[model samples]
Target: MKYSKATDYALHTMLFLVAATPNKPIGVQQLADRQNVSPTYLSKILTKLVKAGMVESASGANGGYRLKRNWENISFLDIIHAVEGTASLFDCSFDHGSECPIQQVVLSAEAKMEEHLRNQTMFDLAKKNKNKIVW
Candidate 1:
């Protein structure tokens, strides 16, 4: 059930973008500083987010990353999938086919978790914590 550090960073980065300045671009160095991570490493995560259409990048001075127009509709699941991919968390090693009882239980749990994540969006979180400093 564990997700990658990249996923964790991506989620936090999205939340920071939404809460701090949804419409304004934030530099990658600033974002990395906030998380105590390397800008180069964070850039890779941002690339995935860009490809997923969650965020867009700008070039030149005052250029960086900002939440996309449809960011309000982006769910947690979307961010997770962007970094982690859509593969099932648990794949039964035994060739018990799709009907494997253990696999079925794990998949069911994953579905419920995904459903919960899908219901929660960055906008919802940002709005809830509007008064607080995201970083």
Candidate 2:
């Protein structure tokens, strides 16, 4: 499945935060510049994360966002759900009335796909990155 840009930013921001030294609140501009994304776009991304209670925000001179929980506690599904809402890979309503046989197959396939995505977590993703990537 294709992940959205919002999910990409959220993942990058979380990984950057996870890699940061203790007690350092990363500024949005810094995250934007480092990730090479627009600051405005990152701000909007963070806003959704904040609303979902995945990340916390601070205000004033020494203000920025930090995770509400540890990296291990934050799941990819959690982030994806926050950014994109639930993965409704199937909607087999068939005009809101009839049940088509083709739709039944589609729904079953979608359910399996959804299960795979839901079972995935950021920690699992991090582990994969840990060996293959460096920065």
Candidate 3:
């Protein structure tokens, strides 16, 4: 149910990239400033995104981060997994193996949530909030 702050930053950073300028690279400082977070910390998150092929980093004065060519097809679940990993949210403490009823329920819920997230992309979100958000 609960996710990391890194995931939160990553999601917002991705949204900003998609909404503000998908092709244009934005510096880590600017991205951090928007969320009031540390540029160094945000950089670490960006690194993960880069490794995941969700975004790419450029060098030099106008260098920064920008979405990849397939960013429009990137689902929320993709971003979430990129930062959070593909580990299950809940793991039953008891040694009930794969037959654990409690684990089954939780896993089912997680699957549904992931399915919903998989249906929602940053491009869709940006388009929906285009008028509402400044970017």
Candidate 4:
């Protein structure tokens, strides 16, 4: 499955926050500038993270955002679920209303793939140690 720019930015922004001090809130503008993303777009992503309780926001000069959980605790799947939603790859897994058996098999396999990604945390994706992202 391909990740949208929103997901990519979310990951980059989250990692930036993760590397920051617990008490320090990095400004949205700063994040955007550093990641070369639009601040407006980044704000939308930040809103999702805030709503998901992945990050906390405050207003003013010292206001920005801080991770609600440690880097290790926050997973890539969590970010995707927070923004895109917890949409399973399979349209219907538990309940099969279609009459086609082939559809059922496809759905089962799709479900398994989704489950695999869900189980693989963000920590797994960000396995490299302080290396320049070659993307």
Per-model TM-score on C-alpha atoms: 0.96, 0.76, 0.96, 0.75
Candidates in order have lDDT scores of 0.94, 0.75, 0.93, 0.76
Q: Flag the better candidate by TM-score, 3 or 4.
A: 3
Clashing pairs in 2: 76-122
lDDT of each residue in 1-135, candidate 4, tens digit only = 566889889887877676555458888998889888889999999999999988999889999988776656787678877778876544644455776686778778877776775676555445554464333
**Cα RMSD for candidates in order:** 0.9, 2.8, 1.0, 3.5
Residue 9 local lDDT, model 4: 91
**In candidate 3, which residue ranges exceed 4 Å CA deviation?**
none
lDDT by residue for model 2 over 11-44, one digit each (tens)? 7787767656324667889888888899999999
- Can you tell me which runs of candidate 2 are displaced by over 4 Å? 21-23, 90-93, 96-98, 131-135
lDDT of 3 by residue, 1-135 (tens): 689999999999999999998999999999999999999999999999999999999999999999999899999999999999999999799999889999999999999999999999999999999987652
What residue pairs are clashing in model 3? none
- Give the clash total for candidate 3: 0
Per residue, candidate 1 scores C-alpha lDDT tens digits across 61-81 of 999999988889999999999
Q: Measured by TM-score, how close is model 4 to the native structure?
A: 0.75
**Model 1 misplacement above 4 A:** none
